[model samples]
Target: MNAFTRLRYRGSFMMRTLVSRSARLMRYCLLSLLGTLPLAVCAGEPVSPLLSPHQTIGTVNCASSTCHGSITPWEGSNVLQNEYTTWSRLDRHTRTYEVLNNAVSQRIVRNLGYKEPATEVKICLDCHAHNPTPARRGARFTQSEGIGCEGCHGPAADWIGEHAVKGITHSANIERGLYPTNQPIAQAKLCLSCHFGDESRFVTHRIMGAGHPRISFELKTFSALEPAHYRVDADYEQRKGSYDSVRLWAIGQALAARQQLDTLADPKRGHDGLMPELVLFDCYSCHHPMSDKRWTPRLGVGPGRMRLNDSNLLMLRAIVRAAYPDSSSAFDKAVRATHLAVSTGQTEGGAAPLQVVSKLSATIGAFLPRLEQQNFSPALQRKVLVALIDESAETSYADYAGAEQAYMAIVTVSNDLLSHGALKSTPALTDALARLLKTLRHDEQYDANVFRKQLSTLRSTVGVQERS
Candidate 1:
């Protein structure tokens, strides 16, 4: 099975049976002891861990034997106490900072004319490590730990002491300043801050030009790829509420679109010298070989015109079309207007005018809350899946980025449907998914015709009929 297929956690079945029984007994005992405790009242708005005012105690503080550092999943624990072990032993996040010391990063640093090694550079460290102001660093803090527990969970100084206490609720932990990682909106914002970029730490075209890989992200897929440390069992849902894979994917698309527009609207980040940041445009648009002849009239601009990276926008548009058809036309109009404005402004070889970018940004901003709040029902998920396929086939996935996003969307929605029993998993469906992924495996070799055909095959295999 591909990475898209869910894998069971590594352990023997007999051991798992014993562990489950023990866990149940322990959980019952704990509940009996704490049934009278009041739930924690949520306090202020969520804040990013990096910006939290509290000092960051080191990973060492979080990894003691009695804390989150158990060698295996602790029976009856609300969380996998072995989170520290899993992260250190298996999570790529643990290696993020270390990657800066490798040859590619060294070359990127050199290409950018920086004298400092990538590890020491502020820009590199911003996302690679849990970097904060010196005052926010506790005595135990060390940067070498890369993205540690506090990086995503917020500074541990305030909440670490009582978070695991017998009667403390999850919300109580949040009140004390634990970042709400379980909330989809909050998770999208936090993940995109580094995965896509935010006002503070963005990957500029300059950085990419210097050799950084183009950033690609889809929340649901990436979260699964993270091989999530915690299981979403009944206990987890009782505490954190339900987990909806499709809803996360939708919110991720909307927020990603909004974030891109917001970044483009920023005067400082949007322009580099006399040009709009090249990173804002699809990388493959200008990079592809002249011999490929992949250009199409789908974007409503003339051939050879630079195009904004609209993968997220395209995905979001499909979502709106499926879930809120009344808003679809308006959203489409805004996207077209932005593209036209960008084309017009870029004719002069500079950034799109701020007014133009800001208008579209606000339009997306207007649609955001609704998108976030809209429940992605099984029917809605299926409709969105069909809409995505229909749009991709009609438009022909003109850019590689959009095609990549489409593939992730298809997998995410399909998986959600399968989980809900709306679609059955089969060898044919599995093979179709793998083939679709293969078409996108190499951006340089991507053939739109092949991709469109694979999309059709997937649609048929999953029993979605072609539109009349």
Candidate 2:
């Protein structure tokens, strides 16, 4: 049997096990978590699911055998009925809450000066689990379940009953509070809230210093890595409309760049006491040993000057230059001005950083709509791939973070090309990609020169000519 068939058989076995063991508890836990809190909207944009006022009905509500808990895909069904099974058995998200009980979490809690366990700490639970206020939690809402179905699908209290009904349309379900995860912009916002953070919950420098891993995200790459529960087949397309992988990557880059600027412009979050938040700067810049000597001028800043982490910004510039060349120079100018302002703010400590952040934010904001509507043709995909490789060859992707993002972008673009038949998979291309992966295998051991050389090999293998 193939992988899908094997998974179906295993899921059948697991379903039997669940039915035999916890059928009673499963029924009880499906109680609704919905309350009277109305969905909040600012201007026209709906509030993020994280900030939504709806009650989060427990995962059990959607895990019944006839609902989304079948052992295999249901005939004539619009969604894969084994969503819960796939998530519980294969997805790492189900184990996020459990991670808090481990030794590393204990050490992190201690380092953060929290006497309570990581499970009990609000900061730790905020991102690790689908934790809402007590008032908003349904009777079956258990934090132990980690990021349950309702976490991403929005609090199910309002729509759970009607969602599975035969006549209820997808749009109608969305109107009742189901989050539009299929939309790239909406997906970016929801994922970035936890990955990069927002006004509500941010992974600050203090948390990183306390042993939390550094945050990194590339939407399309990460989504693929999730091994999505639902297939994008014809049925799914008819219900949710079509999507483009390249557009997902572009929108993700734009939003991530905007979020960074938003953080920098916030009066409360921008700085720590007299110093700017250390987390905003490139970690490798200051963390490297004195003897390493990895420094070279970046953003026109001289040696020994701190540099803001500009991985997303650099990726955004590549996207604009390839797909929207008219805006390339203007966007580059804004980025440079922001860097200079940040550098000057180091000494001046006035309004310079915030001022530049505003300008940069506006520049990126203007592109968001265009990116959402732009169709990334196969030719444009090649242009983007070439731009990413050319920029890496020129800049060497000096920062480890930039190199990491670059690798993800290259894979995303290359995969898109192959899927669309614009590029063929050959042994030379496979070896080139493998070499790039090896170069980026470890952040501490990363060598920019080696990475740059691999980019050149990849460019040549893909038949991208050197830019004159």
Clash count, one per candidate: 0, 1
**Candidate 2 lDDT tens digits, 1-468:** 553343344334433432222223222212211111111121245466666788887998888888878888888877889999888887778998999999879988998899999999988888888878888888988889989887788888989988877888767877777877777777888889888888888888887766676678889766765546877655665665566778888989999999998888888988889888888888777765578877766676778888889999889889999999988888887888788888655323455568778878888988887887787888999999989988875464888788878887887777777767677767887789778877765566568889999998998888842232
Off by over 4 Å in 2: 1-43, 346-351, 464-468
Candidate 1: residue 106 Cα off by (Å) = 0.7
Q: Candidate 1 on 1-468: residue-level lDDT in tens? A: 321111111112222332333334333322321111111222445778878888899899989877889899999777889988888897778889999999889998999999999988989998899898899999999898789888999888888888878898877787777898877778888899899888789899888767776677888767765646777666876776656677778878888988888777777888899988888897767775578687778656768788899899899889889998998888787777778777655322354456667877777767666755666887888899989989865574877778878877887777666666677767887788778767765566667788998988988876742231
The best candidate by TM-score is 2
Model 1 regions lying over 4 Å from their true place: 1-45, 166-172, 345-353, 464-468
Which 10-residue window of candidate 2 scores lowest in summed lDDT?
32-41
The total number of steric clashes, by the backbone 3 Å criterion, in model 2 comes to: 1
